[model samples]
Target: MKAAAETMPTLRAKHVTPHAFRHATAVHLISAGVDVTVIRSWLGHVSLDTTNHYARANLETKRKALEKVTAPTTPGGQPSWKRNASVLAWLDTL
Candidate 1:
């Protein structure tokens, strides 16, 4: 720890641990589309619930999910939200 800190002042032995590295590995595997079950086993977690906490949504995942959505259309030229008077009133209140 002393030798590593001497070369790089920013490097702290206490800041990095095996569990932190495990978290990095889990995030990387998740970003690469690895299954939750697979990750659970790789991390040797006893329960699927423990593995689920790591499955957080980031900006990239949200953008990809949005890309799959089909825009809603009403019979008229305007969208359903615009056509509904109640919705328009609610928006005005906001």
Candidate 2:
């Protein structure tokens, strides 16, 4: 099995290890917007925290995601506290 894997041209990256492949898979899942819970199961991780470490999203990635979801503010726009206030009110009901 080892010989077959080694002979594959596609698997011929220099100094690649099993751990590197695992990390790559985790990162790809994150980039593809797969949930961490799904990744935990896929990677056989016993804890969600372990999956989180492996597929940790950097600050810039999160910022970009938020940017995509939120409307751009015009110059001198009023700060909108209503959104958070409504969320907090809803949480309080729960």
The most accurate candidate by lDDT is 1
* lDDT agreement of model 1 with the native: 0.86
lDDT of 2 by residue, 26-69 (tens): 88878788999999999999989999996677676688688889
Clashes of 2: 0
Candidate 2 Cα outliers beyond 4 Å, as residue runs: 1-13, 58-63, 66-77, 80-94
| Whole-model lDDT, model 2 | 0.79
Looking at candidate 2, the ten consecutive residues that score lowest on lDDT are 74-83
Q: Residues 48-85, candidate 1, lDDT per residue (tens digit)? A: 99998878877877787899899876688898889899
TM-score for each of the candidates: 0.60, 0.55
